[model samples]
Target: MAGIRFSQLIDNFITTIERYGSTVLQPEISSSRPANIRVITSEQVTDCKIFLWTITPGGGGPGVRPESERRIQMTNISGMPLWPGVRTLLGGWSQEFGVYAFWDARRHTKFSFRSPSLQVDANTLETAGTTGIATQFRPTKEGEEVVVAVAPGSLLWYVQNGLPLHNSQDDAAFVVDLAAASPEEERNFLDSAQSEIESARRYDLVETMRAFRDASFRPAVLQAYSYKCAVCNCDLKLVDAAHIVPITHPTSTDEVTNGIALCRLHHGAYDNALLGVKSDCQIVINPNMTNRLHEIGLDSGLEEFKSRLPDVIRVPASIEARPTPDRLRLGLKLRGWPEEQIA
Candidate 1:
């Protein structure tokens, strides 16, 4: 038969669901690309089976290229569940039109999952297959139903049951505590995440997690330090949340105590081991930095930092939020500074 008319079909489908709930049925030609024959049993009553045909492109139909793009702006159809029958019938339609899917644990702590076709890696219906088969159905915050064809990047933190999905188990190899990942480490993570995406067929799950972490954690650090550079009190918006313990360390990376707000200058210095924090919270300029800056004739910036040495860093509002002395010592050690307490 001609391709399925998506608008009329979906409208009727939703109406049927609302008017009378749907029942699972077997497909006559089940293994086809788009299942040709299927059955729906509802209380409204119909003994004859429902036969669905291949979804075809309609002139001005919603799932067509232009119509689909515009429909993305409409929130009415967001978060619709794609049951087995619907998956067989409209899955190809959704893909042809760019409908995406994503799922998350009810809690924000665990990793999330997304439909594979959304990524740069793959896009064809043949590539995506079934949601479970395509993505291997990563564990959600338990009891959460799979949400199909959501707006691009929409996440489901809580399941339909209202329970928060939290995954406490950590995979040390893939999941690192990155307070603020170093440039190299960040690149490594991106590559690793990409590999995971391709291997597990999860398109943008890692990217989504990275975005969520930045949005929630960095602001907390900046606010904890009162939006000023913890080392030199630079108040510019250029201040950053620097991780005291390198993100590679096997500890919580996003905590305010593991972070210190620093301007771009100090952040770069700390990252490069040109600056170090003492056990007493004093900021020290690395001896190598002084020589290097003098050699490069870029010595003016040192006056501000050098004068601040022996003076303690600006502490956060809460004592518990202060960078731990052990982490500070770790920072000094990374800079090759003397371990003896500075006189």
Candidate 2:
């Protein structure tokens, strides 16, 4: 089958990102060799650039080009030819790309790019390298692998009929420094990337995202709560980040305000709907659970659990990090609390 146009792929890429609620400000496409897609999130351009390359199916899994073919030919800032002795001002350059493969009959899947260091060819006035993409900007320990979903898409009709032609000519390399991006900008990028991945409906990727999300969420919530359980103030290293709104809910979010740190016992109770937290941060026990405590063999422990809980759950000193009242209410409602009691 004939390959999709490079322009069409770019359009699809932009469309996919925008579908996740990110705005791609005027993308500046270069009119010369070494295609560029410049996404400007702010008025002032920064020094960070992220180069992206697309990997398509090959005889041996997804194939990456040789370093020589992937090199970025140097260009002046004005989009003019580089003259001798004219140096480029680009800094903090990193390369990333998506690896796409056919998952099943209907969909295509992509995985996160590996982190690779860029090698500058001074004599040739070009830059390129072959390395793995990091899942995030943070320094990962040596030999540790962090895999997350990059994006996935439904196969086009023509692509479903046969192997789509692989065209390296369509690859557009661009760069952005996520470490320097504002929180909102970072969230936008994550949201878009996650949306793309989820669309594939692959079980492994879904589970991976869930685990990754919780792994990332735990530290943020634990720090906000001083590494202690909000209900009982247990400071042992047994605390976990429990989502106020259950993860299965459509409206659930990973925001700190939507999470609370709790020890294993309280976390289990909260998830089971036997324990609830009001909008005012008051700890409440379900009367139905208490009435039937003996039947569940928790009659003796239930009283002790109630005694240990504070009048109000310990909250973060930062108001922004505190649990949102609306989310708390919704959480309680989801846990089968009566509307009157939830308020």
What are the candidates' C-alpha RMSDs?
Answer: 19.6, 19.3
**How close is every model to the real structure, measured as TM-score?**
0.42, 0.45
Residue pairs with colliding backbones in model 1 are 106-157, 106-165, 107-165, 179-253
lDDT values, one for every candidate? 0.44, 0.47
Model 1 per-residue lDDT tens digits across residues 23-116: 4233343332222322232112222212222233333555544432211111112223333422222232233533333233122222233321
Candidate 1 overall Cα lDDT vs. reference? 0.44
lDDT of 2 by residue, 1-343 (tens): 2333444545564454333222344346643222343322111122112222233222223346334321222222223233232211111221232322211111111112333222222211111121111122112332222111122221111121111111101111101133133445544544554454443322223333344344445567878998789988886555778999998887887789999988888988998888999999998888876777767786787777787777888899999999999999999999888667798
TM-score of 1: 0.42
Clashes of each: 4, 10
Candidate 1: residue 302 Cα off by (Å):
2.5
Query: Which is the leading candidate under TM-score?
Result: 2
Top lDDT hit? 2
Candidate 2: where are CA atoms >4 Å away?
1-201
lDDT of 2 at 139: 22
